[model samples]
Target: MDQEQIPGGPEGTGRRRFLALATGTATAAGLGSVAGCASGGDGTSGATLKGKGAGKGSTPEPGPGGFDVKAENARPGNADWRVTKAGPARAIEGFADRVSVLPGESFGLHVSTTAPRFTVSAYRMGWYGGARARLVWRSEALPGVRQPEPAVESGTRMVRTRWPRTATVDTKGWPEGCYLLRLDAQGGEGQRFVPVTVRSAAAAGRTVMVNAVATWQAYNRWGGYGSYDGPSGGYASRSLSVTFDRPYDYDDGAGLFLVYEAPLIALAERLGIPLAYATTTDVARERRLLEGAAAVLSPGHDEYWSPEQRAHVTAARDAGSNIAILGANCCFRRIRLEPSELGPDRTVVCYKSSYEQDPGFKRGHPATVDFRSAPGADPESSLLGVIYDGYPVDAPYVVTNPGHWLFEGTGVKAGDGFAHLVGVEYDKVSTGFPTPRPIEILAHSPVVCEGRPSHQDTAYYTVPSGAGVFATGTMRWVEALDATGDGRSGANHGLDARAGALTTRVTENLLRAFAAGPAGKTHPAQDNVNAVYGGS
Candidate 1:
């Protein structure tokens, strides 16, 4: 939720009155004037942040207990240490960014404050059964010693500590959902909530499952900021891999990791729809996981794919199935994963070398086929009318596929706008990707050089097999909904209500289509979509 900025009043009377009122209220409530223990942590409540035994006028002695926004200059009475603005608070955001763990993976949460900083702890919240709530992940702050000063990076001051910010948390048994990680500091005015989602399960149902053949699970490794943010590491390069010690953790690499298909899940739960988690690998095994599923949900950032996964899904749809591709740069590369034990137990290494380096690892193998036109290429591009385009650009999206049933209740128009929906701009069905022209151009956003390059966002052709696929090449779709209450309003952020609803409907449509099939008929598209399309 966006915070409304309150206008500041006169310097003297206004400020004095506000402080006086706050002090009176605090006193009445038995709250301390000095920075004190925050509520709901293992530490004592109401303890000031002031250091214990130090000469007056000298630096205050370090306070006992944990502080979320630790800083050397921070003091019990300091007001500047607080974050009163919207968005991430500069002091503690570094520790609140993305945290990615594989299925059944365990990891730690680290928190360090600036010099003169206090203490902090973390918690988790999300949708359960249907309501929003949270649970404390830590009973108390992990132990650590404070240093007076630490090395500076990017010309900014930071405190150094060896606290056990690390822990062994696993993702193996949790159902896929949006999780909010709240970090709070002693003496700090408020808490910071970081949004993270457990990657969707690669299993379809009781039996069918998608495999995680070659999965690259690192964020900020290719470091590119949002389309509007400054250019950073590896933005211009196609791909590269960095080797780090097993269970490697970072505080600076927060920008790259974000929520996928965030809004769709919320909608599914709200509308009483069940979602199945699976990867391309599961699809290849002819697993019955998806057999009885009402809908298949692929959240944002589903870029890597395998040929068999593509073919089976298309075949299932031909028999009758529904699919929703919630984000962009999806189904672009056919990748191969060679398992290794050098990393954390569940961590797999997915190095991006040229597809030609090893013919066996090429895109045509069962693991890496491009399903574009059948026997070989991934059918995703042809099915969705898009291919993963290169990235680092954001542009407004225009609706062109207006006639499709997906827009049935949306009341959207031809020129209606969806902003920054396409990132890296690669898929344009009208131009190529073997997409049929008869496919409706429900939405189209024009692009031009802003010194850099751009691409168009388009939704094209349905499967000859009777399935419907929806793809948006934008990174912000799920995130946008959180910024705006309604997708079409464009108020809180740039999210569009119609866009949000359409995506959800499309996902439901696909799953329902797939479920309308025989118990073992994996590619039941024609039966699912209620239509028929046969190559012969």
Candidate 2:
């Protein structure tokens, strides 16, 4: 359900749109229990059910799944303010507070609930003769908890549904207009509705999907083996053979470096673009997935890579797909996954030495681009012009290329404040065919380079390939998200709009550039032969 279109836009062709987002409803139980919420019901259980709702005020009912729907504050000693419902079937029973939406503004429905298990559903309430309304969003009381309703649903019911949250709806074809939004219960609760309006399409051109799901291990390794919450500390922390398949909670201190993803995702949506997600493995295996995608985003800490994944993305770009490495240390290493018979999935398996020493590693395909001609192969560094500095922090950065096109809209004066944005610095013994060149020096500083430790970061580069390739030289994009408790506000970071706009504009221009031009055309004129075999 796409809520992006407002009535009477350029696409005069009429179509139905979809959208979803919910707020203010009863809470449900936690993941470990089956009480309060309607369960799969395998029989023997102690959980009860009740149903209650507000507005015209339905009386509290007696039976399984029943409760009073009131707005009274919690008792003096309680810190949690909540709403609850008991019912025999799963249901949506409250309004996220009625919202009056302008013609194109984004509005969220806030809901709180306690049903042990609950789902928030929003449907267009009133009737419109020839107009179509979309419920473009649906989120859960809890983030990261997977509930499949077009509306928000919570895995554990005791928590309140949050704002700035999201759910996916297919709103690709709705005529702009006003519509009612409401919640519908799935298995335990009944149905309810709220109202929302569609604003003008003044912001569609700015729409660009922000991708936070890591194709690699640095920021997203939540569920597979070797997850941070799993037995081992994962990847760089250790050289263990662990595979991670789940997501990390940004609120959890462990994700401090990867949290920038939240706002980027949020901002993209606010700008009218859908923020899509995927594991690197998915990109490698799915081509149709990226079809129609103008820009391909690798946000926050995208540190790992697979042979197939790299090849497809490069193909997409060569075919004119724009690319954004929103953070540093991108495409740093490669790993192979081995399947498991039990438990989540195979760990992000890697044994690089076998590639150098074993014929099998050389005979079979390796994931990243390898331009190495002989024995020692470190294609990643060669491809990117720098290798991992192996250090976590460094001196602040300085700008040398403030005049570049990326800095166009921002009134940034050279040498004012640059390194403030960089998170890491890296360098290598520059050499060979894959060497970075015709690069624009965005920023440079006299610091110990990663390789020499005595002198580096003295130079930082942003290369332009028919399409521009911007590199921050530092791996600190996550810091922008952390600037404020909420990722969208830039003032929280002490960065003026210019600095904030720097990130936003670069992203905007890059996506637009990709959509406007063909990929591979940027590379030096070469034969049509595939540069990397077996990918396309």
Candidate 3:
């Protein structure tokens, strides 16, 4: 894709004129300072920031029960200590039995190491009185053993580590929230992490936040085989099926959680929104988890999904549970789950190839390929109001419908562009797909993708069931929350202070409104796609 065609690109004079109009309108409106911007050193306005400890210039203080802040220097982008770096390179590394579990349930850990022993610590992530995470528990140095990577099987290309359990942490008293289990080998060689969420089954009247674990496992290359084969080989070597029996090879075992999911989780907690947590697998196996929820949140980069999981979420929305997709490229791949040698429903199978290559394809099942492709033909746009477009381009997020409630504050106006917010991958409401009628395309930023001129869209749509659906239409939505570009989010994506503030305000508005209940019941989306673009 040519960079010159993107919004705010060097060759786009129209965008410059629109920017002038937007800036002028905002200045004339006399929008005051967004609340809470200065108070919380974290850069988010209206929310009290916590967890700024010693590493970031704040005083080192013990958390509840005198638990030491072991990861004092742990911040974004520091690869070594950041909760997201992948590991086991001359260091002890591990992963959890499950991405999430209910309180009072037992959670297991699988550790791999070159050292004889290692210590484990649990930090509950939240806005805890200026500390981002509070030390909850720690384990003594325990015996460890390194395990060999599992060999790839024939047709499926599935890899299973079959590593034995290293530790089991009882979750009897742990609060329902995001937690990072940190592992450090003896001799201080290095450290890594495994992210878990202690979920709540009783989600009545609360928003349900789902961590995209399936996508993480799909991309995990712990056994040298992810969905996408690395430089070592091509599609022939890629794993058609991946098991959760091994540690993640990226983001310190957190996979894509830090980049795509963590920021949104932190922000939701900071706002004290009534919330519960779960994994994509959890929802797939148990539909009842979202039965009475007020809303469901799908994080950034939720690409792979099973039919059962899709049905559950769609049914929940039909029952009036609002859904907010905070990123693009969501539900793009159709996968099927099967019981692993370790446990049930631990294997995700997606053969991104020809129908003949997929065993299930011949059975008249949804082809294990892109959701919008082939026999299934179930376009995500029908559910998300936008479909996955092209990739590898970065463009400004230009607001076209700033008057919508989602952009209530922060002084945004028509044609206001948040630089570099549209990136990596994006979505659009296209007539070629099954788009929901009466959808509102909020941001219409033009960019060139695969040498073709196209526009990315952030959209909102309402259904008769009183469910409100929203899509950010960009993969960088969550990363923009790191207003300071501190690398906590891994890559900065060129986001600046203005972009952060604008995104934060817009996110706050979305969450607050959705938390009230089904937003369609109160503020139904008015179809503006035709009005804005002059066509259906």
Candidate 4:
């Protein structure tokens, strides 16, 4: 392979024709038109967005070995608001004091609502005896509690919601896995959820999967303010900081966990893979949690990262723990964790608009902005093998390097496009940033982003410490795990049956390999960057 001979290169007629045909067919089927190319662009072809397949509404039957395809129970209302309406309604919604806990530890709940009474139920998520989850415990109807109204700080535009503790749950015998606490108001006001992870004290020799709770809280807009939304409900009124004390306002408070994190957990448990669970805050507070783990799996839309969290995970990789980043736009935003009025590590501070607003901006620290931005200047590509490029795209995920081990048993070939698997946000390798050398470019799909033509890449790279890093370079990777195509709005990205099958196969391959000690020790990635791009 040579630079000009690459799949989407100018000299590759087959790929060009394939893309053209795929775009035309997609457009004819009522999907959106392909994005236009800018002049002097990289050698990649543009693709039209495709509609969700007609099989979107069909339920997937169990696969071989009795593997269940349904894991929607992890989310509140089982991914259907109608089901939530049919059940007991509740006005109160709350979240746990801590995003995660260990066995033998007690965690508190912070509730908010006008109802006078409510109850909590704990459901441990897994592939339990053909059912996706099992109810472990239920509380007697408890008095409903409300927190003080959120007050805006005068100077920073931060909303501090100092909620009083309502109830406490003891995890004396809770199993080590993902658990969702369902809050129901006896007054029929509706339902909501608080996600909790029971950390395994015995995480040695297991693969540790991290749930991106920090990112979820960062985007949470419960108190009329989020890191993305300002006081006036506009982007310009965005808050510089967000607190975790507030309940998520979307999807009955399940937030992004169900679509992005639960599918991977369900799939891992179904395969009976030895697994441990933790949150970004947990890793930041205690680095020892990652010790002796075979790998750390970061799944789905993990955009926000703290300095300590990055350092801990980087140290783990250097000590020979494999790293698998299963989504794009990962480690893109650099943020700092601070103790809120409630407790430690409860506030996420990121001044995305102006670095001057950051307390450490003038101290020569990594600015509270996108990692690749100035003053910080630490491109995530060095760690992720690819950097965030652009957004608002929905194109096919074309396989460029089918010979890689990650594609084993997928039956994909060069130029083969998995319908609607790449979308909304994607990443790519560029010489403009500090990328690891000798990296392999796997999926190089051309798509338009904000009117500029570019390419998205799935990359794999290995380090001398016998640690391997893999990135999917697309936000839709984990959402596609729901072969049934039932996902939260704005998260599913129109994935269908074919996309689900392809993503599941590749994910299984990645998990199995990473679970077995250091992946680079036995299956080192063969770098083809020079051969493909003619770079040094």
Candidate 5:
């Protein structure tokens, strides 16, 4: 039920049906910030970077927590940190002023509540035996106030709050990983989530995992407005810009992490892979964060992107870092980041197809349109290999090349099917787009989207620079990682252990190979496009 940025909608309207389906357990989780009573972890310490630019390399020396991914998860994890009771929205909710912080930095968590008081617990996401997170910090009870209602900017229809800082979170001893902060209201009135990423300053020699912050805020409707729809009762009145100054109204304010990204993070951590964390915002402004990184991993449902980020990632790929796009419909929309009341890159600006009216565009800036559209005219397929085809689909994924290294251990034969794995939204290898050469089509699945017959595809391609790029072509790929027979979790979308087994093995093969170094040199792709789509 993830809400996407609809292409042809109007000014402002209520949420589509999918946004209303965000009522189940979070399914998975990621990231955290600010801790009290924290004593150990690994990351650059004390060198707080507030709006710092382009300084990409190793972080400050580790403080109390020494830098060791294996040692950090070796500690006993606290399963009690998961939110057991998420009450009404007014019960308790909050937002971190910064999307990410270096270890030992301080950031404000602006919270609102109908309860008189609330407590906060910070959980660093990882693999600890069966426990997926560790309770690294907890704050003493703090007074709570229902902050002022969010204000909508008149011209841009942007939503933001003027809330005072409810608490100053200190990350003196936090580990550099993904974290989720739980807001527990007094007297059991309500509980909510606020997520933060303790990003790695330097991701050299590790696989850099990117959090899709832009896409998360693009779908946020806290003030009853977003890039997709607005309160004016139509998409035509949609906000031209959305600010991170307000709380997220989706998934109980945890944003999109639990369903879309957390499972992947958990699996990666479980593998004990050398991993670095950053949001798309971090990648956008930093020029060399990916330098010497063995690989870059973009998680599920990433759509909105800044041009600077694309340039950085392209540069990284050119430098031989393997690229793994773990979802479909990624890098579809072009967006610009501006500062908000709090700081830089806090505002996500996009006019969709209504780009001509954007103030930035009128000033001779790149228009905030689809990346493939005329205003910019740079199609994402040149980067992603698979082009986003359509949405609102549910079809079994049919393996077309089970012999590929990605499916090495799966033992599936060609024509094997995983029910409902290609869903909601999908991508396909299209010759019509600006496609890279020697791309291999791995899976081909038929679907009828909005009554239009078409096929979805999974693809992998290798460039001469020895960089290998793999795309999943399905948004449900991450969510299916945790699928069980009962289909109890909202993330699974009814996919069973069959789908889980397939994705897990393939992903394991994918990541381990990519992490070893330039994947094209180690496991170069074999082109098979002609065999899959003859004469097309």
Candidate 6:
């Protein structure tokens, strides 16, 4: 079920978003429950599941035997689940009133369609033995009507919808995982996707999956406006703020998920390790998030991050929770999460180069700028162990340290290169910023960005808290995981099966080790800064 798209043009590839607002205020708003959203008791006692960490979810089931993620994914999958017919942009489409929800909670569905009837199929994304997703819940055919067109706020240029709530989904017996609620019109007229995360409240000893919700909305151009360009396609007319209140455009209305996230989710779930889920928004507003988690997985293209989330994730890292950044330019943009018409933290505000006009900045709040920029001066390298460098590149990913534990199963010698594994955007270990010490360089790929020669570096470092952090330095890492064929937008950059095998093996290695607890205690990073940089 998909609708209006940001028409393909000179800047339609979505890569332009990476370069857009490369330089970038919003204020933190109080958290509140969406009007129609309410939790379904803990699923154990039906005791109202009240008090504390509302909507974050209850404690995750004990162990592999408890929730049985392996068994849950073993259920028969729907092969005809993809949104194959995106007939017209306005044929059928909708958005969830909430980004995520705890099991048993009910959330409103706001839909707009030219078709008279449409059905909602909730598909939890996982391996499903390569079926990729399992149909969890399906709704009876619901009546539809065209919602009012969204309007951009005069001052902020934010586009928001006032669509009426069409249906209320009750997640009583649903399993927690990343979900794509497919809206399908009757008679196969059209189809579009609306993503939602059934988040884990407590991730004490499981690998926590984090969906980059804010980044998804930041790049969403549903109403002909985004962080990159507005209706006129001028950078100056771009929205300073984007809201989750509206549905996304591009890739059948799935935003960046299928491209930068779904493949990785499939691989992770394929490993069948104990898993929990949360979005970046949950990390920012939830209490004690990731404190006792085994590991945290940040997906490809996770760029916009709120300061509150940075503090929370950094605290988790310092408390012995391993962190894996599988994307370039993660936590690079400082943002403010504010309340929307439906609920709290649904609006992401990033003033970009026009931060001076952001009221939050004037009030001494965190400016919505680059994490490494002024008024903050906190380089992402301080946490990511790599600084974001150049972009728009396609080069071979050269193995610099094939002996590293993360690459243990991937048989490759030093200098063995995987063509096109480093591209679009990249990061590098640089001493010029606030970087951690004892960081090891694993892959060093030479690339030409905008006709400038530079290099991409994959790195790892360990903090004294016994937590180990590894960064992939390239956004293509996730895309390559599914390189044998399926690319959501055909954005796999020609990476072949070899590259796919290489990424999968290393990812498996990383997840298995990190899930056991603090990885620094078992496999500490070997420093090679001098060897890689030649003493600078």
Give TM per candidate. 0.53, 0.50, 0.82, 0.81, 0.89, 0.89
lDDT of 4 by residue, 263-283 (tens): 888788776666777888898
What TM-score does candidate 5 reach?
Answer: 0.89
235: Cα error in model 1, Å: 7.1
TM-score rank, highest first?
Answer: 5, 6, 3, 4, 1, 2
Q: Which tens-of-lDDT digit does each residue in 187-213 have in candidate 5? A: 999888899999988988898989999
Q: 1-536 in candidate 3: lDDT tens per residue?
A: 00011011011121121111111001111111111211112211111111111222222233331212222223221122344333347367777766677765666677778877666666666555335565555554566677555677878777776665655555544456677878877776668878888776756678888988888887787767777763365655677788887777766666787777777877876776677778888899897878878889998779889988999999998999899999888998889887876567788888766556776667776778778877767888888989988766678889998788888888888898877888878898887788877788889999898688989999999998898999999888887886666333334766787778877888999988888888998888888887767787
Clash count list over all predictions: 93, 100, 15, 8, 17, 9
RMSD of 4: 17.0
3 against 4, candidate with superior TM-score = 3
* Model 3: CA > 4 A from native: 1-90, 362-365, 485-490
- Angstrom error at residue 300, model 4: 0.5
Report lDDT (CA) for all predictions.
Answer: 0.37, 0.35, 0.70, 0.70, 0.80, 0.79
Q: Write the per-residue lDDT of candidate 1 for residues 1-536, one digit (tens) a residue.
A: 11111111011111111111111001111211232222223211222221111113222222221111122112222122222422233334323112333433444434433323333322122233323322322223322222122221131111122223222222333224334444444445334444344434333321121222223232322122111111332322312222111111222221222234334444443433333434444454444545544335455555555555556656654554555555665665554433222222222222222333434545444433333433344445665656555444556666665555545666677767765455433354434446533344455566653464544654534555445555555555544444434534434234555555555554454334433433123332122111111221
Model 4 segments more than 4 A misplaced: 1-83, 86-90, 360-365, 485-491, 534-536
Residue 239, model 1, lDDT: 28
lDDT score of residue 12 within candidate 4: 14
Candidate 1 yields a Cα-based lDDT of 0.37
